[model samples]
Target: MAGNRAWILKSRPEGLPDMSNFELRDIGAEPLEDGWIRVENKWLSVDPYMRGRMNDVKSYVPPFALGEPMQGGAVGKVVESRSPHFEVGETVFHMLGWRESAAGPASAFNKLPQMPVEDHQWLGNLGLTGATAYFGLLRVAEAKEGDIVFVSAAAGAVGSAVVQIAKAKGMTVIGSAGGADKCAWVRELGADAAIDYKDGPVVKSLLAAAPKGIDVYFDNVGGDHLDAAFAAARQNARFAICGMIENYNAGPPPAFRYIMRVIAARIMMKGFIYTDYMAEMGDFYRDMGGWVASGAVTGRETIHEGIETAPDAFLGLFKGENMGKMLVRL
Candidate 1:
């Protein structure tokens, strides 16, 4: 039986994900079956990694099956349970498919501790994206006090969090965003300055903003933007290769001449994935959650209403349409 709403990947894209790549199916309820709980979806996260998942090649993760429900991070309330561990009316987050409803084993979901939806989304912030920033900046970039740090995608989910976290650690933060408004948003997040990447030649602007060569580069947008960061980095600078949002929607692999700058300038460049550091999360959650509660660290999110619009919301990340974390309200 088809329900009223589910976003299915009608086809994978050769480049950007447009509305035509997805099909909204009106799937009604399916039987709970044994040992399964049926959850009414409430919120879903739209992230950059979803772009890579659309490809047919093997990667660190599996490709999303074509013509099936595409899945990402989601939260929902259990309306019915056939398992012993969960009861009705409990909320949880899981790798559930995109829809108005989902069914899975109790073990398939993690029970959300009592907290605001924002806090429950710690699974999102302090979860994958947070860990990405944490390990990337601290361990890979080797962030130090008084370092001049530049982060691309500075107003999106991970970038917003990176600005505050670096600020808290006593670094001078400069951010790069797609527009003037997002530039202002990043400055409000405590970055010392924010450059608009859209304003022609990010390299020239970044060089002008930092004046002194950049000590750390947290690259969320690669390609030309990364090329710019390289031009501005100081000797022995640290580069944390996080995501390449700029080129994710299209393009050939970026040129590597700039990477030679890393060796010539003695810059340290490293790439990291969050799943590699799940073991250190207990400590990060305690430290970072405290910073958030104390107002020392803050996060922002752009919420799009309705599961039907989730694809549009996700596609928005490529355009810098979101200010902070992007979520879809169900």
Candidate 2:
């Protein structure tokens, strides 16, 4: 039997994770059990959420066990199938990521539909990334037409989607990115204004971008961004607190000097996970799928080739190295 090479967590990371915490090991491939399917992974998703999983603390999702193959989202082609539902050569999406291949029961995978977009996109724009933006902005934030919306980490996978989706809904969108190039990309995605956060204090820039005050804030990078949103939000404003990438590496949480604004402004703030809105996934797919197919809601990806580069791809998220979605093409 051929050996399957997989990335395993050697130890839990204290702050920023490095190569020393991971080890690639070769394990002998075993015969498929009943109702199992063997899949050759073609693409792997490296997301910010996976950073939380590397820690030992309890979270919405269980921490990645030491010595086990780390997992995320992956799209693969089934080469062998013992189940009637899955067939040889069929493509499917599953959570068995961070490896070159996986063998699991057919129930663990969802078959991909025939679409004009590439199969890898099923892990990105047309998939969880897009869904996160859709539900976070529309459902959680309750954004409406003519509302002023601010999105932190605006050029990232989920933030970029929020920028475009808010635009599609006729909202005035303000985006914040770390550099000039990412800021430009956010503007190109139809943001009314894109703030280069590296240039100055985000609160000042957000105030300048939306002097009238923001109605909805889609927060991807929390900390300073959350403080700025609180200061710039209008009365009865809504905040959808998504991932807080700024504090992912383990550091002092950002002190909010303007927290009083949350009360004075009567702001509604809610932290949400995408899975919380799983019941509305069908609506998300229908709407986001149409917008993607029509080119109204666009998405970009930073592809890192080879499974060996997966760790680098994930680490790059902290450096703001990716403009949009980051994926490893296996």
Candidate 3:
């Protein structure tokens, strides 16, 4: 039997997530139980949404339990299998915990087709992050041709996707990132303009970038970003309220003042979770997969080379240290 390491959540975090909240342990492999398989983890995602999971309060996704293995999206290769649906040598994606290995029923994981060694991995641009951008922008924001699309956190995983998708739809895109490097990267992703939110007044900058006024705002970072989006919206503009990475660290949820703009601009603001539209997965895949294959759209990954460094990679998202999808390679 082999022993594998796992990182578990020991306590709920206060403000920013610290290394003290996690503890490492070793689990020895045992005989497979019925309907279950053992997987060797290959890649794991470190996303901003994971911050919300540490709290005890209920959210769109359930909170992580103390003393339990901290769970998130992971891709792994099956080393052993007892389930008929999976077999040895197959790779799968699941809500497996942060671990070198996992054993779970076939129903717990979605099997992925094996790809060439150089092919795009399923953890980033080709996976959920891409799907979130495709549906959240096209479906929720209802982007139209010639629309001025503004996206916050434009250098991050989902934000990057929003920029490319908007450009492909024949809409002018403007993005906001934390620093100059990210601003340049957002422009490389096809945004007509990129604003450094850290430079000055965010709303004022966005307004200047899109003097015609923004028709669609695909918001990933909330708080001040949302307020700014509201202020820059055109009459009858649509705002898609996605993840709020900005306030994820704060102890209490942040408040925003936007009633006046909501009424005056007649802005349509709506929040969406990916699961709510699982029925649309087929459409999303058809469009995104084609775009990815043809090089019409692309994704970038900021990979942390090993499992031990996963915590730092996860913490970096809050600090804007990553320029694309953050992944930990095992």
Candidate 1 minimal-lDDT segment of 10 residues: 115-124
Kindly list the per-residue Cα lDDT of model 2 for residues 1-330, writing each as its tens digit: 376888999998889999999998885575899999999999999999999999888999999999999999999999899999999999999999999899988899999877788888898878888889999999999999999999999999999999999999999999999989999999999999999989999999999989999999998988999999999999999999998999999787867989999888999999998889989988988888899989998879999999899999999999999989999998
The per-residue C-alpha lDDT of model 3 at residue 78 equals: 89
- What is candidate 1's lDDT per residue for 174-198, written digit by digit as tens? 9998888999989998999999878
- Clash totals for all candidate models: 5, 0, 0
Greater-TM-score candidate between 2 and 3: 2
Alpha-carbon runs more than 4 Å astray in model 3? 113-120, 251-258
| Cα shift from native, residue 94, model 3 (Å) | 0.7
Residues 36-111, candidate 3, lDDT per residue (tens digit)?
9998888988888899899999888899889877888898888999989988988788888488888877899888
Please identify which of the two predictions, 1 or 2, would achieve the higher TM-score against the true structure: 2
TM-score of each: 0.92, 0.98, 0.95
Residue-level error in angstroms, candidate 1, position 213:
1.5
Winning candidate number (TM-score) = 2
Which scores greater on TM-score, model 1 or model 3?
3
Best by lDDT: 2
Model 2 misses residue 201 by how many Å? 0.5
